[model samples]
Target: MKKFTAHKKRVAITTAALVAIGGGAAFAYWTSTGSGTGSATTGTTVPFTVTSTTATGGPLTPGGPSQVVEFEVTNPSTGVQRLQNVIVTVADEDGILWTDAGGCSYKDYFVSDAVFTAGDVAPNGGKVTGTVTIKMNNLATNQDACKGLAVPLHFSAS
Candidate 1:
C-alpha cells in the first residue's frame, strides 16, 4: 500500500511538470514583431483682434445718460467661436477718491450689465461688434470725486 501511494504522488508531479513544459513550448513558436510609420496632424491656431470704437469717453457729467462704447472683435481661427461673454476691468489713471472716502460707488455709475450679444465671428476671418453702455451716478457725493476722471476700460472675451 505504501509503495502504491508513493507511485501515485510521483505520477501527479510528473503530469504537472509536463503540462507546464508543453505550455511554454507552445508559446515559443508564436514570436514575431513588426514596425510601421505614420504622420501626426495638429489643428491650426486662429488670430484675433479687439478694437474699441469708443476709445476715449469723458467730459461726462453726473446724472448723465448712458454712454455707448462700441467694440469690434475679429476671430481668425479655423474653428468657429461665438461671442459668449465680455469681461471688463476699469482703472483711473489719476488717483480718485478711495473706497473709504468714496462718494458714488462704481456700481452706481456704470450699468451692471454692459455686455450685449454681438453674434458669432466666422472662422478663418470674421467680425463681431458689441456695445457697453456706461452711465454716471447722479449722486451729490460722487460730484467732486469723479470729476475729470479717466477710466480705462480693458475688455476680454471667452
Candidate 2:
C-alpha cells in the first residue's frame, strides 16, 4: 500500500483513457481513397464483301421458266459473323414482278424480301452462300416493258 497523490491519480486516469481509446480504435472500421490511371480501347471494324452474284435462266421469257438467284458473301473479320437477314432487291428492271402463277413462277415465289435466316459466317476469308427464287410476270402475253432490260440485282446482309 503506497500513498496515492493527485499527480499520480491524474496520470493513472490519463493512461486509462488512452488505453480505452486505443481499444475502441482497434474495433472500428477504416476507409481510404486512392486513384490510378486506366485505359479502355474499342474493337476494330470488320469488312464484308460480295464475292459473286449469279442468276439462273437469264433473258427471262415470261411464263417460260422459273428463275433463281444465287450469291456469295465473304467476311474478313477475326471473329465469326452472325447474319440476321439477307435483303434482295431488283433494280433497273421492267414492270411489276410477282412470284404467283399469273406472276413470274407458277411453281415457286418469294414469300418475303429477306431470303436467309440467322446464320454464322466464318471469319477471315470465310464465305457463305444464299439463294432466292424469282420470276417475271406470268401473264397472257409478254409485255415489252419486261423485256431484256438488264435489270441489276442488289443484295445486302446485316
Candidate 3:
C-alpha cells in the first residue's frame, strides 16, 4: 500500500508541471521591426478676372475733366487671394477710328494706374471694387480727332 501511494503522488505532480509549461508557451509572442513609404500631391492656382464697371466724370474732351474709372475683380479660384493694385491701360486695337477722319491713337490718352492695399478676395466668384482715372491729355495739335469716340480700357491685377 505505501508503494502504490507514492507512485500516484508522482503522476499528479508531473501532470501539473506539464500544464504550467504549456500555459506559459501559449502567452509568448515574437518581437520584430518594419518600415514603409508614402506620398501626396498638391493643387495649382488660377488667375483672377477683372472687368470695368462704370466711368464717372467723363465728357472726355481734350484737357477736360478726368474720368474716375470704377472696376470689379472676380476671384475664380478655390482659395482667397490678395489684390495689391490694378494697372489701367488702353487696349491696342487698330480698328479704333475717330468720329472725324483725323487720326486719333492711344498716345492721345492717359490712364492713371491704381495702387491700394485691398482686402483679400473670397473664394469662388468673390468680388471687390477699385478705381483709376483716365483723361485725354491736351496735346498742342488739333484735338478734334478724338471727339465723340469711345475709348477702350484694359485692366490687370496682381
Tens digit of per-residue lDDT, candidate 3, span 57-154: 85988888998888888899988888777777776433342233467767788888774448898999998877889899899988777888777777
Off by over 4 Å in 2: 1-35, 92-117, 139-142
| lDDT score for candidate 1 against the true structure | 0.64
- Winner on TM-score (2 vs 3): 3
Indicate whether candidate 1 or candidate 2 has the larger TM-score: 2
Best by TM-score: 3
Clashes in predicted model 1: 1
Between candidates 1 and 3, name the one with more favorable TM-score: 3
TM-score of each: 0.53, 0.55, 0.71
Once superposed on the true structure, which residue ranges of model 1 sit more than 4 Å away at CA? Answer: 1-39, 44-47, 55-59, 92-108, 112-115, 139-142
TM value for model 2:
0.55
Would you list the rank order by lDDT, best first? 3, 1, 2
Cα error, residue 131 of model 3, in Å, equals 0.7
